[model samples]
Every structure is written in structure tokens, then in C-alpha cells.
Target: MSEPRLSSLRWRVTVRRHPSAFLLAVQLLSLVLYPLFDEMRGGRVVFGAFGVLALALAVWVVNRSPAIKWIAWLLAVPAFGFSLLSVLFASESLLVLSSALEAAVYFYAAGSLIAYMMSDHRVTSDELFAAGATFTLLAWGFAYVFVVCQAWYPGSFTGALNPGQPRSWLELLSLSFTNLSAVGLGDVIPLGSTARVLVMLEQLAGVGYLAAVVSRLIGLTLLRHERR
Candidate 1:
């Protein structure tokens, strides 16, 4: 094969061999790129490119294990829908909504895939950490954006705060994430039942998922060590 062909074929094989790694790289890129181009122009391009790459990778993954088709299809449906809306939508608010939804889906997909790998107990430590770290990066970005944009939020981000809260957009974004991560920063106080409950949900999901998956990985590693 020519060099270009070889590289393309190699990526295919690599993705098929290591779906976790492929997903990790894509998730990491999405996290970093999302905030930098919140405007959606540059984001659309990157998102489309990643989508194409993911589809290609998915082809290999599905061929090897059709079971992954379930996950791949679920992730792809929203990702593709958001991408389409982001490109075709007439209103900026619609686009923003799509982008935000895409972030949630991406985070969930990354988390679920990592969870799957952890349960496999066959993935290498390097691959596991790399995937976990990528997922963490997305979580960090999501939380950071929530904090940075706190001031501009018109209502309770997670139904916890009021529209009149005196916050800058950045502050709200940061606080949203801080609450999401369950950091208990103690600065953004929830004034209503919705805010308090929302805080707990975000915190619980953020910490619980990571902790559960990380523990599973540790167990796998320990099991392997015992075997050796």
C-alpha cells in the first residue's frame, strides 16, 4: 500500500484492535475543541471531522464485535443529529441547544464505553487510564464551561438557581461544573429546592461514574497481578 493508504489502513486496524483508544482520542479532542470554539463555526468543522473518523472506526469495531453496534449506534445518532442541526439550524439558540446536548451525549458515551472496558478486565492499564483520562478531560471541560458561563445563565443551570442570580456567564459555567463535579466549592449557594437537588444529581453522576469505573479497573489490575 502507498503511504497514505497504509496509514488509513493502519488506523482501521488500530481502531478495530483498540476501540477504547480510538474513542479516547476522539473524546479528548471534542472536549478541548468545544470550549475554544463555542461559536460553533470551528466546532462544526471539528465535530464533522471527528464524526467521520468515528464512523470509520465504528465500522471496524462493529465488524469485530457486533455488540458494540448498540453503543456505536446510540452515540452516532445524537452526534449526527447535532451535527446536522448545528449546520442546518436557522437560529443560534437552537444550535447552542444542539451543542449542549451533544456534550452530554458525548460524555455519557465516553463514560459508558470506559465502563465497558473496565468490566472487560482484559484491557491494558495504559489503555484504561488513557480512556479514563480522556473522559475526565471532557468532564473537566464541561465543568469549567459551566463555571465560566455561570453569570450569563438565565435560569437555574440544573434547575437549582433562579434567573435573577447575579452572576456573570463565566461564573455560572464554573459553578455549574463545580456543582456538577460535587466539589462543594461553597461559593455558589443554591437558594431553591431545584438548585439543591440538581447539584446532588450532577455531583452524584460525576463522582459515582468515575469512582465505580475506576474501582473496576483497579480490581482488574489486581486480578492480573495476582495471576502473575
Candidate 2:
């Protein structure tokens, strides 16, 4: 085999071995890139390309998971397609629809990760990575929910940076992180009844996720160490 073939083979092996890790890395990388892209002209095109890549990686990760893989692809294909269409046509309705679908895809992926983690007894490296990936997935899911809510109810969210104005994607994401983590540290505040209700649900989800998933992982790790 040639050098390019060897490199490609290695990459494929790594992805198969630890697909969740790659998904987690892309999610984390987006945290840095999203804001930078927002500052650039024609950044929506770049953002759309990156989102497609992420969704493709997500579909791959879901395929390796315990959950039904085809469902994720079903949701993801239209989600990213709407996203791409929104970018190209600059249609607000398409953007909202895409966000809603993206949220569903993220939440489904998160649930898939939870199933993957719980299906086995041994604490493997991939399961560990899935834990983090699941958290980010939930956060992204709720952020997109916020996006849709803001569209439905204008002035639903306000931030220190731009009071009374519509929140940006980054700001909504920040709010999602803070609410999901139960930190309440973000400057973005959800004011409308719909937004507040969503925040409350996310808060409960954060606590429940930590209590259920993280606790189980730690307990299993400890039990394994003790048995050794």
C-alpha cells in the first residue's frame, strides 16, 4: 500500500476504535470556532460546512452506538440539509426549521450515548469519551431549542451585550451551557414564559444527567478497581 493509503487506513481505524472521541473533539473545537466564524464576512458558509461535518461525524458515532443508527441519519440528513438551504437562501423560516431539527438530532444522539454507556459493564475509554460527548450534545440540543424559542417569541432572551435585542447563536449557546450546567453564570437571560420553562427543564436535565450517568460511571470504575 502507498503512503496516502496507509494514512487513510490509520484514520479509518482510529475512527472505528473511538468514534465518540472524535465527536467530542469536534464539539469542543466548535466552541472556539463558532465565535471566530461569526466575526468574519460570509461566515455562514463556513459555519454551514462545519455543521455538515459535525453532523456526519455524529451520524457515524450513532452508527457505532447501541441505539438504532438509521433514525439518527434520518434526522441528521434533513437537519443539515435545511441548515445548508437556510444559508444559501437566507431564509429565516428555513433557519428556524433547521434549528428545531438539529435540536432533535442532538438530543437523540445524547440518548444514544446514554444507552451505549449503560449497555456494558466494563468502563472502557470510549464510554468515558461518550460521557463528555453526551453532555455537549445535550447542551447543543437545548441551545438550538433556544434558537427556535427566540424565533417564536422575539425578545425572549436578553444579554448584557445587547439588551432588548435578539440574542446571537453564541449567546444562546452560552445560555444553554450555563443552564445545563446549573451554573447560572451566563449574561444571557431568558425572560419569556416559554424560554423560562425551557431553562427549567434543562436545569433538571443537567442535575439528572449528572446524578444518573456520571454517578454510574464512577461507581463502576471504583468497583472494577477494587476487584483487581
Candidate 3:
């Protein structure tokens, strides 16, 4: 076979065999790339592009109904497009709106993937990948919400996050996962009632998700072992 044909075959096989893993890898790569790009000029533009790419991959990975896929595109395209436009136009309102939309998209995607993963009786590597990817998406979804809150009501967070500059996506991401893990490090503190409420809700969600999903996955794994 020709090189192009071989590459095409590999792509098809990968998408068929490990779509969840591919999505997980891309999501992780995007997180790493976001922080690195922050140091450069036009970084937000690059970041927004990656966000769109990740959103597309997420839609593909979920492999939901046509209507659902269309809905994902509707939310994700404007979220990423308006984000890039906000950076260019220096519109804080647009940025906040875009962040909210992005959060909504990720939340939907994460919920869908989690449901799909948990629906299965047997545990597989793809299921494991989907589980991790869902967690990452949840973190990102909350991070975007945090960004929106911070943008809408400046000083929502009191420490480490500077009001003068946009919060670092990476730092917000860290805070999100920390909150999800219920670590509650004091370095970044939520000041406003709204912020506090949001934090509490996220913590609750994280704990609930772990208790339900992790336990289910473990149970399935044990059952598979018994059957074997």
C-alpha cells in the first residue's frame, strides 16, 4: 500500500478503536498548550483555535445524535469564535459571554461522556479514557465559569488572581481541579457570595461524580474479573 493509504488506514483504525483515548490526548495537549501560548503575542487567538479544535474532538468522541451534535456545534463555534473576536476587539462583555458558552458546551459534553461510560456493564480501556476525559472536561467547564465570574464581578477571587490582568487559564484550571479534589488551598480564595456558592457547588459535584462513577467503574471491573 502507498504511504498515504497506510496513513489513512491508521487514522480510521484509531478513530474506530480508540476514539476516547484520542479525545483524551487532545484535551490534555490543549491544556498544556494553553499555558505555553500565554507567553506569546496573539496567544488568546491561538488558545481559542485550540479550544475550537478540542470542542470538535469532543463532539466527535461523544458520537451522539445528529441533533445533539448540531447543538454542540452551535454552542462551541460561537464560544470559540466570540472568544477570538473578544481578544481582538478588547470586549470584556463578549469575553464573559464566550466563556459562559464554552463552559456550557464542556458541561454538556462531559455529562454525555460520563453517561455513556457508565452505561456499559463491562470496563474497557476506552471506558477508562472516557472517565478521565470527563473529569478533565468538568474541570475545564468550571474553570471557564470561574473566568466568567471573575470577569463579571471583579475581585470575585481575592488572592493570586490579579484583577488587572485576565486570570491565567492554567492557574484557574489548577484551582478548579483542586476544588474538585476538595483540597481547598488558600492561595486563591473566592470572595463574593456568588463565587463562594459556585465553589461549594463544584466541590459537591466533584465529590458526587467520584463517588458514583468511580464506584461504578470499580464494580464493573470486579464483575469482569469474576466472570473471567
lDDT against true structure, model 2: 0.83
Per-candidate RMSD, Å: 5.8, 2.1, 2.1
Q: What TM-score, computed on C-alpha atoms, does each candidate reach?
A: 0.61, 0.92, 0.90
Instruction: For candidate 2, write residues 143-219 as lDDT tens digits.
Output: 88999999999989998986978988888888899899987697999899999999999999999999999899999
- Please provide, for model 1 over 1-228, each residue's C-alpha lDDT reduced to its tens digit, 9 standing for 90 to 100: 699999999987776666666665765576566666666454543464364346435333523456655555665566556556656655445445544544554454455455556555574844574545444444543543343233234344433354455443334445655665566673556554555565566677677666876666777778888999
Error of 3 at 56 (Å): 3.0
Number of the top-ranking candidate, with lDDT as the measure: 2
Q: Write the per-residue lDDT of candidate 3 for residues 99-206, one digit (tens) a residue.
A: 898899889888878877778687888888888888888888898899988887777776554655645666677789899988877467777888899999999999
Which consecutive 10 residues in model 3 have the weakest lDDT in total?
158-167
> Mind sharing the TM-score for model 1?
0.61
Residue pairs whose backbone atoms clash in candidate 2: none
Clashing pairs in 3: none
* lDDT, candidates in the order shown: 0.54, 0.83, 0.79
Model 2 misplaced regions, further than 4 Å: 40-49, 59-67
lDDT of 1: 0.54
Q: Assess candidate 3 and give its lDDT.
A: 0.79
